[model samples]
Target: MEPAMACHADRTAPVFQTKGLTKTYRQGDVEVHALRGVDISLYPGELVVMLGASGSGKSTLLNILGGLDVPTTGEVRYQDIDLAGASDRELTRYRRDYVGFVFQFYNLIPSLTARENVIAVTEIARDPMAPEEALDMVGLASRLDHFPAQLSGGEQQRVAIARAISKRPRVLLCDEPTGALDSATGILVLAALERANRETGTTTVIITHNASIANMADRVITLSDGVISGEHRNSERQDPNTLSW
Candidate 1:
């Protein structure tokens, strides 16, 4: 959807906008095109779900949006910052200050407790929520002292989410946040994400291959062969507890 069609009436400028975005890599003699002229505008405080199969370029787009990578030939803007033309140092600062990322794997330090893991990011953030507050948002108030090894996979993932949101980032980018869990556990994780989005009002983008997850988003965009093939708006978001794989 265009930036003008924002779900929130107060939001005028898009948090992220990309035009003719492309990413190409040379693997031996073959040129693999991960993205091909993708154009999208993600608005502030809206939950967006990008549905695509394997190698459909969703992850590549997320990486570029998160400042982990840059587009080859396009204009990528995060508000007024030009991401496509940014230097490595600028990109680093952009990521640290404005973006929060959650991946399929919970990359929590094994030695750190849940609170400690969240503290690691908040300590460096310009403005941060208390570690307890973040964990409470995810329904993990009682597990503050548990280490990664002591927590279940879903619990560990929740801890990771707590850590990401603790920084109070303007945007939260999640790549397959529930990919590693079973249906029931995945719902819990999705609920945490939904809670985070609802409570914090962060512009959230979740990229996944599962079509069922689309019901929980304000907007759903499908990618095929590196381009956005379909886009739609959901009148009302379904609760994550009601969603099944």
Candidate 2:
């Protein structure tokens, strides 16, 4: 293995690994390569931020890692399971059993109360925290009965965080989670994710264009034109409360 793709000498097996990962989308005579020969490993309980400009393959990488999409080439290993080689049934089970996702927009059901929305996920999980407890973790305990329209943007985002973590997924994949919120609100939403990572020891990966948010992560990976352009490991991560927007 190349030194760049090698795990730290002191580190154990990675929670996630990608080897020569590639994804290509065909359109008639043209082909768009979303990812090319990407090699990386992510350890457990670490918070990672992916920084990239538009068309940089950040979203594509996140999708493949989360089992929402499969790569055209290469492999993805989630612990002992090789995701790229998993059958559709196995992929479905893997997503349900191990992965959680958060996106820019809160996809809460309008008719359901905050607690109900969270319970929707817990109901399907094999082992899950109480919906009320999950909401409390995101600082939404008092808003349990409120519907989506009754909450502010940040509160709605918090509810979404509660939904994602209710199942206690081993990995959390967030894609532009704060893109739709104001800076102040975005900070709070980011804090919720940070708290989840710390409290549950869940490995977290966030994809963002906002460089300001990178300071809160233990490592940052920057991608350009479907390849990793830079990889940085921070010596210390600032508490989310101290992070600036």
Name the candidate that leads on TM-score.
1
Q: lDDT tens digits, residues 196-241, model 2?
A: 8888988999999999888788899999999999999876676666
Question: lDDT (CA) for every model shown?
Answer: 0.93, 0.90
What is the TM-score (0 to 1) of candidate 2?
0.94
TM-score against truth, every candidate: 0.96, 0.94
Question: What is the clash count for each candidate, in the order shown?
Answer: 0, 0
Error of 1 at 122 (Å): 0.9
Clashing pairs in 2: none
> Model 2 Cα displacement at 24 (Å)?
0.4
Q: How displaced is residue 197 in candidate 1, in Å?
A: 0.5
How well does candidate 1 match the true structure in TM-score terms?
Answer: 0.96
